[model samples]
Every structure is written in structure tokens, then in C-alpha cells.
Target: MSGGAQADTAGRHGFTPRARLGLTLIAGGAVANIYYNQPLLGLLVGEFGERAALWVPTASLVGYGLGILGLVPLGDTLSRRSLIIGQTLGLAVALLAAALSPNLACLALSSLVIGILASAAQQAVPFAAELAPDATRGSVVGQVMTGLLTGILLARTASGLVGAQYGWRAVFFAAAVVALGMTGIAAATLPKIPQTRPLRYRALMLSILHLVRSQPVLRRSSLSQGLLFASFNAFWATLALLVEAPPFNLTAAGAGMFGVIGVAGAFVAPLSGRFTDRRGPRPMVVAGALFVVAAFAVLWAGGAWSLIAVGLGVLLIDIGLNAALIANQTRVYALVPSARGRINTVLFTVMFVFGAFGAFAGSQAFLMAGWSGVCAVGILLAGAGFLVNVLEPRGA
Candidate 1:
């Protein structure tokens, strides 16, 4: 069946299959920038020293937090098409800078900007929510999120292969090209929908805080998702390091192939969304958190000894994390139809901030205590997420 057949359009303003495909691609491509450095971290350290390598991943995630806080909310205040185009163009520039960087400092700075502009992915998300009717909103979000999540999981593989063949520099140049193409694609495919509201910048930013304070469901969803995201990032941030130096030593590309395997989890989006539409988001969110805790336990118990365990852990974590995210997003988007953009900003800003910390902690843990330390980090974070969901207020 046509992907369009699933989401019944409401009127002239309803979403089209063409737009859905474009947003999916754009979301995938735009977000991939922040993750490109992961598989290349060893190469980066070889040139820039261990201290310098830490900033590479941490800076990208931190910049993503900044971007989500500063730019994504503008979805309610500016044309999403314009915002996407501007961010994509800027992302292209950032990639070029990373490619041309002469020092670790330069590369890290460029990575930060890449992270900031990658919020374009978040823009594509809320834009999807905006155009989708209530009935099929979960389904459409699920489909579009498939692209975003796939881009994220696949980025490591793409960078690992390109970095292995040409060099890390080549990966950034190729990413720059992708960003440039995405700009053109955004121009051609995205509709010029008007802004939802025109609040001043300060008020717009403040509104996010208000939503966080006022909405119990929003708080629980964002915090729970944030903790899970931290666990997910911790695993990715250290996976290359772990595999590169072990009894089962592997090359960069070998380390990255796990991402392809994890694609199994990314494909769950549409199904999870449909499940939410049928059963509600809460049960799905709980199930997802449980999966994460179990994934970490698997990694801790067997990751250091068995490739099968690590692979299984990867599959479980990705499935659990993305499922929770889709359900959490559906919950928030339903809260305020007009403030979808701002609501998303709060969720993602919290999420990426925790992600940044996870990367930092994971790297440090690996340096201090090896694979065991990294697994411990994931377990603690995932446990916290499980607690948050289980302890959610009776009505909240």
C-alpha cells in the first residue's frame, strides 16, 4: 500500500506522501551530522590527543541542546520551510568547516555548529505534527521518525566506511554535500506554511518553561525520555572504543556495522505509533523503559564476553529508546495543538542535554574502568528512567 494511504488527509492543508518522504529524508540527513564523529573518534584522537577527542562528541550533543533551545521553538514563530532551509544551508557550511579544520579546536567548533543546525531535524518533526490530522498523527509521526532514527543509527556506519577508506576529513566533506542537497530538497518539497503564532522571542522561550512547569505528563515524558537518551548515547559514545581494543578487535567499519543491525529497532516506529493510536502512549512508554533496563543488563552481563550479547543489547536498546521517544512525542504533541513546536523544544532540549552528559560520562568511564564502567553508566541511567515511569503520578 502507498504510505500515503495510511494517513487519511483531512483537507487541502493535510500532509501529502511527497512531503512525508521529503521530511523523512531531511530529518535523517540533518541529524546525521551530530553522530558522524562517533565512529571516527579513534582517528581523531590519533591526531588531536585524548583530551581533544572528548570534546568532539560531547560538543556536538551540547550544540544540539543549544540549537533545540534557541531555534526549534521558532517553528511556532517562523515558517518551517524557511527555518529548515536556513538551518540546512548553515549545516552545509559547518560541515565544510569541519572538513577544512586545521586543528582539534577548529574541528570541535565546527562540530558544535553542526550540532546546532541539526535541530532542523526537530523542525521537520513538529512540522509533521502540525500538518497531520489527529486521527493519523501518531502514524505519520511514526513514519517520519523512522527516517530521523535511521539517519542516527546509520551515521556511524557511513562515517566508519568513509573514514576507513578516504579519511575522517572525507566524511565531513561528504556530509557537507548531503546538507547542501537537503537545502535544495527542502526548498522544492516542503510547503510554505504560515507560522502558528508570532510571540516575541523572549515570550516564546519562556513559554517552554511554562509548559514544563504546568504539564505533569510533559514533565514525566520529557524526563523519562531524557534519561533513556542518556543511556543510549553512553553506549554509542563508547562502542567504538570498546570494540577497537579487545580480544575481539575490529576495524572502524566493523564497529559501525552494529548500526546496520540496529536498524531493526528503527523500523519499529510506524508500528509503535499505530500501537499508541490504539492503546495510548503510557503503556508503550512503560514497556519501552523496561526494554532499556533489560538491554543494559544484557550488555553488562555478557557484552564483554560475547559478540552475540553486544549485538542483542544494541537491538534491544534501539528498539526500546525509539519506541519510548515516539510515544512520548505523541503525548506531548497532543497537549497543545498550537505549541507543538515549543513543546518539542523542551523535550529535545532536555533529551540532548542528558545525551551530552552521557557521552562525556561514557568516555570517562571507559578511560577509568573499561567496558564495565560504561555498562554501569547505562544501567544506572536506564534504571532511573524505569523509576521515573513507574513512579509517575496517579493522574499525571
Candidate 2:
């Protein structure tokens, strides 16, 4: 059944199959907005000059981080259905603005707005958690995330293809059309959920800090994910540079194809969720960290010399991160039901900050020592994550 047919009763009866699918689609589509500019940077630079390459993608990413911190909290304060539909409508305008931009300033500003609205995707996540039955919540989150991760992994490739054929403007123009369709779909599919917490905006923001102090699981989960993200970003920040030089001699497109290799990780997410449901999130978290640690080991062992080793390491690291993410998120959401939105805010904010540090650290490491430096960075971060899981106080 389509979402329009199901929306009327979905809230009372809980989420429907089509509604879940809608959430997954919304998550993917909305998040894809923040990434569309990456592959179009070359084209942007051609028209707007070198600064476009630096500022365009940077503006979008910064906007996404800010949106997560600012807009995502509204999920707990407002009707999520209304919020999503409104954001999609706004995203449409932003994308259009991007497509028609005559100067870098206008384009950068539009990109910022696009990134801010893109947090609509993150809203779909906790919404899934809110509606899901406890037994299957992990599985649901995993499935939705599979869509999200795929959109992220594929956005660059899609943008490259569109930009190469039709021009960079066409990519944003097409995205605008998609956003309008998403707006309509959201109105049809999203259940009209009443606000659970009635706190004002200021109070709502402050309460996130309160939740942080109050929930140990939230702290640990956020920290573990942060550490793991540091590892994930370390690999990604340096992958293109590593492969494009000497021994590997891969072109940019070839390096980009590694993103496709990471898709295997997304497919494993649902299985991780199922396992977390049965065995509890803790073991999965531990196992995830271990997998990452082992991935770094494989990379350190031979990844620099052998493309096969690098490919295998990519698969393991992605699987580890996604698996840990599903488990960590499941545990965090289960913690204060009324505060899941704020909890998510804290989680993602920490992860983003740590990811930035990882990128910086990995770059420095690669410059100083080469591939081994990158591998060491991954090991240290993943190992720290493993330690966090193991050293938990045994029932806090």
C-alpha cells in the first residue's frame, strides 16, 4: 500500500510497512542533498574559480553538521510529519537556488540551506525508533540506515554522471525535482504524530545536555561511535590520495569506485540489527570494534602493496562501523523514550566532531609516514573503541 492510504491510521496502529519504506526513502533522499556537491566541485571550479572547489563542498558539510545540531531537535517538539514535509519543500527551493546560482556566494549560501534541510534524513532515524516495537527496533533502524548509507555512498557517483553529461546545474535541478516529489510523498506517508515533549526551544536545547549527564549509556555509545567514526574517516580522508599516487596509480574515478565497494557494509546492517536484537547490543558493539581492529591489521599487513588487501580492508571496516552503529544506536534509543531526539543529536554531534579530528589526524599521519601512518590511526581509534566496550562497569 502507498503512504497516502496508510497515513490516517498509522500513528494509532503504529508504523505500517509502506510507512517504514517511506521513512527509508525519505532518509536516503533527504541526506543525499548534502553530498551532491562533492563530485560537482570540478565543474563548479571551472565556472566560479578555485575557491569554489574549497567553499562549495565545505559549506554544504558545515551546514549539515549545524542542521543536525539545530534542526533535528525539533523532532521531539513538533509533529515530525509536518517538519519533514516542510523541510522537503524548503530543500526544493534550496536545490533550485543552487542550480540557478550566478555567483559563488549565492551558490554557497544555497548549498548551506540544502545542507541544513538535509537533517530531515536524521529525523527519519529516531522516528523509526519511536514507532518500532522493542523486539524489532534494531532491525528497523538498520534497514532504514541501509537506505541512508546507500544514498551517501552513491551520491557522488550519481552527481559525477549527471554533471559529466548535462552540466553541474542539472544535478541540482534534478535534485530539486526529486525534493518536490519527496515533499508530496512525505505528506502522504508520514503519520501525524503528536508531540511527546512540550518543552520550548530553549528548554529543549538545554535538555540535551541534561540527557547527556543523566544517561551513561548515551555517553558510552556516543563515545564509542565517535572513536569508530574517527577510524572510518581516517580511511576515507586519505583513500583518494593514497591510491592516486605511485604504486596504485588509480585515477580519481577509480578511487571513487571504492565507495561502491563499501556498499557491502550497508547490506550487512540489517543482519547486524537482527543480531543485536537477539544477543543484545553490547556483544555486537564489541564485535564491531574487533572487526575494525582486524581491518586495520589487514591494511597494515599488506594493504599498501596489494589492491586486494586494500579492498578487503575496506569491506571489513565498513561492516564493522555499520554493525557497531546499529547496535550503538539501538541501545541509545532504548534509553529515555521521550528524549530520543535529543539523544540522537548528542550522538551525531560527537561523531561529527570526532570524524573531523580523524580526517586531520589521518592526513598528518599519511604525510609523515605514508599508508602505515593511516593504518596506525585506524588501529588506535578502533582499539580505543574496543577498550570502551570491554571496560564498561558491568551494569551501570
Candidate 3:
């Protein structure tokens, strides 16, 4: 193995068990910040009205989009620990601002700030890439991503239950407290890694354009992952509508139970990583796309079977999404070991942008076509992703 590959493998594989657990916790805490608003959207709507609630979530997403563009690239230029710590502190204050807001506008503005600062989680992924060995990059990324997905899935359930019991304000307060605690842990535990020489901000921004123009794998992987994430977001965004209406009218608590079903994907993520290590990312990418397509088919088959079908579909969607994500990161990290942060900024900027679009499109789809419309759009997106995989260079 080359020196860079050797460093990656040693960094990933050589961690003590305690250190690994700490990294996992950091990943979970950082990612949970982004997802905390998801299940609380309905409550926000009740307090602020539907239009305001709809825009509030978008505010956070818009902030997140900007973070990917502006904040994440700092990983290449500054100390990782300082960047993570500063961002975490900023996020905590933003969450507290959201918690204390007296009106929808105040809350919405805070959400944007929180989302922008929450790019700390994005930085962690590339940090993990830097720490892992080339041979086992997929496995390392998979393990970390397991924590990430757990944070996302469990945050929905936790926020909904907490908001129902305590109130929405309490949800942000608790999140703020957790964020503070995690920031301390990160400062004490995260290892110091070498920083890249400083580049002009404008020059760093231009590098992404160069990456887009030069890298085939980055292009294909980013597009395919973006579409898959859009499809996944489309389902979750509209799920409440499905459960609240028609034959099965589940309460918020009951609807949150589906998040538990989706946790199965976290378990499946490691297998996908192992597959990526052995056979490379392409076969796994193709299989993941197919699994998502299958999920749409199952959801399309309505009835009592529809409930079981949708549950299975959620599992498949989570698995497929995580598999492709880890594989893509593994590949991209290899291509630009020195620029993992910049590469991830480009990758996640696209993913989150599509995710925001998916959420909006799903709502529109639900408003227009209902469950059938949602499923149709998902099928189309999955099919498009599969075609992208087919067109990818064979050896890559």
C-alpha cells in the first residue's frame, strides 16, 4: 500500500475501543442536531400555522446548504478540532435561540443559524475518512454512518415523544444541553490531526468547480447519491400524511414507531461496508439502487399488506441509502485524501440540496396525488439512480 493508504488504514483500524466509541458518540450527537426538527414540524405548525411551520424547516435546510458551501471547506484549511468545537458551540447557541423564540419568525431564523452551524457533522465524516486506512475505508465509514443514521432515525422518535410530553421548546433545550456536553467530549477526546496549508477562500471555492469538471467517480457518485437521498427524503417527508389519514389513523407517537422499524438499516450498513471492501463500490451501488426500486414496488401494493409493505420499504430505503453513501465516501476519500474536507463539502452540499428539494417535492406530491403520487415519484427517482449506476465507468 502507498503511504497515504497506509496512514488511512492505521488511523481507522488502530483506534482503541474507547476512542472508537467516542468518535461514534460525536458523530451521533452532531447528526442529531440536523434531524431534531423533523418530527416536530407538526407541532410547529400547530403553534405557528402551516405556512410558517413549512418555512421554518426550510430555513434550517437553507442554513445547512450554506454551511456545506462555506463552513465545511474550512476542514481543509483549519484545525479540525477547533472547527468542530467552534461550530458545536455556535450550534448550541442557535438551538437555545430557537427554544426561546416567542414567534415563528424568531424560531425560523434560529433554525437557519443552527442548520448552518450544524455542518460540524459534515466535517466529522471527512475526519473519519482521514483516520481510516484505505483498505478498510468503507468499513470505517460504514461504522460511523451507522451512528449517523441512528441519530437521524432515533431523533425523530425522541423529538416527537419529547415534544408531545414536554413541549417543543423543551426539545431544543434538551438538544442544546446535549450539544454542550458533546462539545466538551469532542475537545477532550478527538485526536489532533495535521491541517492543510491555508488557501484563499476564493481559491478553495474554485477547487470544487475543478473537482466537478475533472472527477468522473465524484460526478456519478454524487448524482446517484443525491437522487437516492431525494427519494428517501420524499417518503419520510410525507409519511405523517399517510399515517394520519385513511384506514389507519395513527397518532404522533404511533407514527414515530415506524422509525424503530427503520433502524434495521443501521444494522445492515456494516454488511454493505464489508461488501464494498471485498468487491469494490460498484456492485454494492447497483444492488442498493435495486433495493430502493424494490421498496417502491412494495409500497405501491396497497392494503393491510401496505402497512407491512411500507415498513419493509423503509428498511430497504435506509439500507440502500447508507450503502451507497458509505461506498461513495470511500471512493471519494481515496481520490482526494489531502482534500477530504473539500470533497465532502461538494458531496454533501449536493446531497442536502436534493434532500431539501425532495422534502418540498414530497409535500407537493402529497398535496396533489396523495400516497400514490409519492410512491410514483420515488419509483422514478430510484430508476434514475439505477440508470446512473449503469452508465458509470466499469473499473471505477
319-362 per-residue lDDT for model 2 (tens digits): 99999999999999888776777888999999999999999999
In candidate 3, stretches whose alpha carbon ends up further than 4 angstroms from where it belongs are 1-15, 42-51, 303-305, 360-370
Best by TM-score: 2
Task: Select the stronger candidate by lDDT from 1 and 2.
Answer: 2
lDDT of 3 by residue, 1-396 (tens): 443654465485645555455566777787787678877888888898987657777788788778888988888777677888898898889999999999988998898898788778777777776776666668877887787778877987888889889988999999999889878977877776655367889998898899888888888888998998899889888887888776788886777788898888886776888789899888888888888888877887762236777788888888888887887788787886767788898788788778877878888987998788888888888888889999876686
* RMSD (Cα, Å) of model 1: 4.3
Q: How high is the lDDT of residue 164 in model 3?
A: 81
* lDDT of each candidate versus the true structure: 0.87, 0.90, 0.80
TM-score of every candidate:
0.88, 0.96, 0.91
User: How does candidate 1 fare on TM-score?
Assistant: 0.88
lDDT (Cα, tens digit) per residue for candidate 1, span 225-332: 999999999999899887777777997677878888889999998888989988888888889988988998998899997889999999999899989999999989
Clashing pairs in 2: none
lDDT of 3 at 48: 88
lDDT of 3 at 134: 65
Per-prediction backbone clash count: 0, 0, 3
Q: In candidate 1, which residue pairs get closer than 3 Å at backbone N, Cα or C atoms, i.e. clash?
A: none
To one decimal, what is the Cα RMSD in angstroms of model 3 from the true structure?
2.7
- Two-way lDDT contest, 2 vs 3, winner: 2
Provide the global lDDT of candidate 3 against the true structure.
0.80
Which predicted model would earn the best lDDT?
2
Clashes of 3: 3
